[model samples]
Target: MNRLNEQFEKYLLDNLPKSKSFHPHFEKALQQMLVAGGKRFRPLLVLSVTDALQPLLLRNALPVAYAIELLHTYSLIHDDLPVFDNADLRRGMPTLHKTYDEVTAILVGDALNTHAFFLLADAPLPADTKVEIVKELAREGGIEGMIIGQAIDCWFEKKKLALDELKFLHIHKTAKLIAASLKIGAIICNEKEIAKKLYDFGIDLGLLFQIQDDLIDALQDDTKAGKTTSNDENKNSFVNLLGIDGAMKSADELVEKLETGLEAFDTKLKNNLKKILNNYLYRHKNL
Candidate 1:
């Protein structure tokens, strides 16, 4: 699995480029951030959906997978900016704004945002399919999705939100892209029925993921988390609203809910998806 991850990372690195004589500083920062990898979890979902369906499908899904990762990284770079989270570290290294200048970080993030769509638009797939992919990405990553989620997050800081509102915030901010990743993969194979099922699965998985991330930030060390921790005091997080044990229990319930939803799909895909979610959740329990 790690080898597959390495190969996917290389694929992104190989494709990432700029004119040789063009501005190098911002481009260099973008490259460095991409190299300082995370779990590649978003891309993995795209690839895994295709792999579980059929390995050959990876060729069709790879570009979309890479685009999702690029878009996600773009969000991270901006999220860590001084005006946003002001995070100093990411992936165990100084954040883009910290390593480079804030100006460079902003531009690198802008470049990644536009570049992600360019990749999706250029993906080697049927024209109709490519168009749908682009639309899905925009819907998930744009104002109706991740962007709005961020706005809500910023607006709600230091203010308590209802549980449903909190779920809405995360479902759009964090889960939409993940849901889109799987949906895009299934669309590559024209598997709409299955895609919807996996999309729901992705949303549930994302909810669990954000909850775990919140718990980690509230309970773990920066050194262990590869980024700052104990920063959720005023943020809209599961920890603040649900408390630690309540958040854990809610996450477990979500896992069970997802498992039930997965039963609507093929048994094999359902089982594999559950196993992946379980593994990721299991590892974080220690964090």
Candidate 2:
């Protein structure tokens, strides 16, 4: 692992929401999902861009990376609610609702979601830069993006969406946030030209990620996945839509596109992306 990657785990651990309250377990519940380990994929995309483009700003970028992580964790918490996937496990641990109560889980997700913006607002970057970062995160992770996608997914369950529509659903729900992470890092580094380019690539990368996840869900058990598996039977997932063989073909085409896309960046960004993506690029095949 990259040393920065190692350091980020510690940084995230040290910076979780902390407080004293009359409500006993709320504090613990707030910190539960954050502490429960999952792949720190989104934040690392932000950090990698900043690290490659502007090492001097790497330390300053921690807040940016952390803000993305907080938003992502909050989404996971709410996503695992009884209304959504309702899975008992997440990141290999019992979900927040199961560990505590549904109300606690809901409130904790709310807290994390709100705190993400607060981090951006409180970051030490210039006013304009902070505004851009906040706007990008909001546009990608809010109603225009993740929320609408989730709404579509839940609303359209058991109803088959066309291939393009499924792509739209996952792109907004998953890809846009991933795209925002890369673009936000570029924004922080003041690399405006490449920011859009990275974001475009991130969209495809995130779609590939979702497909790979669907494949994992179809092929792996809960014990292997550390979360619920075979649960997308009614959901409009790629595995359910395209079947395993067709999904694998889609993943293959995406991997090729992403490889070509990675090569287009300057050496620093390309190599950085390659390093992060190597372990994950063809991961579905193994499954």
Candidate 3:
């Protein structure tokens, strides 16, 4: 995973767009956000599934993986905007809107969003495959998915959300894109059934990830989290709604379910996934 992450980071740096006639500051702002470190988990999901199916095709899937990262980054930028979460920090640095002007941050997010589609469209894959990938991403990232989830999150601020409601909010906002990442890789390899199974697995994984994040925000400080803590105080989160212990229980159950889901895959793929889950669980043991 570390090696793959390094390779993906290099690919991103090499392929990211540069300003032509635009002001240097515009390019700088975009570059700054891109270089700011992140987990790059979504793109890794793309690579992982592709690696399992066809290692040779992993090269061809690079653009799609990068596209997911770009879209994820764009969402982060916007999510930290004053109009949204009003966050001041991200990845241990000032949020984009704080480092640059709000307008610059907004434009940078827009640019990244469009560039993600451009990368997907320009990838060296079949047109039909590209279209399918694009459709999945658009659906997951657009109003029907993440956007609506954001809307609900913001609109219901200060109001407690029920457990089911919280699940609905995150399944679309967080899980959908994650599920799409796996499905996109599966689609690229012509593994439709695997795509479906992976999508289901991704839903559980995404919810577990979100629950862990909520615990981090509630328990850890800013430095440990590498971002602002307590930002979800008034937002809907497993920690806020379910309490830390309950959220941990939920995460444990999800992990068990995710592990069980891996039974559908071959031994090699299942082992790879178990490694991922084990690493994650080990890292968050303190939580």
lDDT of each: 0.83, 0.92, 0.86
- What TM-score would you give candidate 2 relative to the actual structure? 0.98
**Judged by lDDT relative to the true structure, which candidate is superior, 2 or 3?**
2
> Could you tell me how far off, in angstroms, the CA of residue 161 lies in candidate 1 after the best superposition?
0.8
State the weakest 10-residue window (summed lDDT) of model 2: 1-10
What does candidate 3's lDDT look like per residue over 34-115, in tens digits?
A: 7887888889888878888877898999999999999999999999999988888898899988887899999999999999
lDDT of 2 by residue, 1-287 (tens): 68668878888888888768799799888888778877889988998899899988988889889999999999999999999999988988899999888998999999999999998999889999999999999999999999999999999999999999999999999999999999999999999999999999999999999999999999999989999788899999999999999999999999999999998999998988787899888999899
What TM-score should be assigned to candidate 1?
A: 0.94
The numbered model that scores best in lDDT is 2
TM-score of each: 0.94, 0.98, 0.96
Model 2 C-alpha RMSD to native: 0.8
- Candidate 3, lDDT over the whole model: 0.86
**Candidate 1: 10-residue stretch with minimal lDDT:** 17-26
To one decimal, what is the Cα RMSD in angstroms of model 3 from the true structure? 1.4
Off by over 4 Å in 2: none
Model 1 deviation from the true structure expressed as Cα RMSD, one decimal place:
1.7
Query: Candidate 1, overall lDDT?
Result: 0.83
Looking at model 1, residue 158 earns an lDDT score of 91
- Root-mean-square deviation per candidate: 1.7, 0.8, 1.4
The residue pairs that clash in candidate 2, if any, are: none
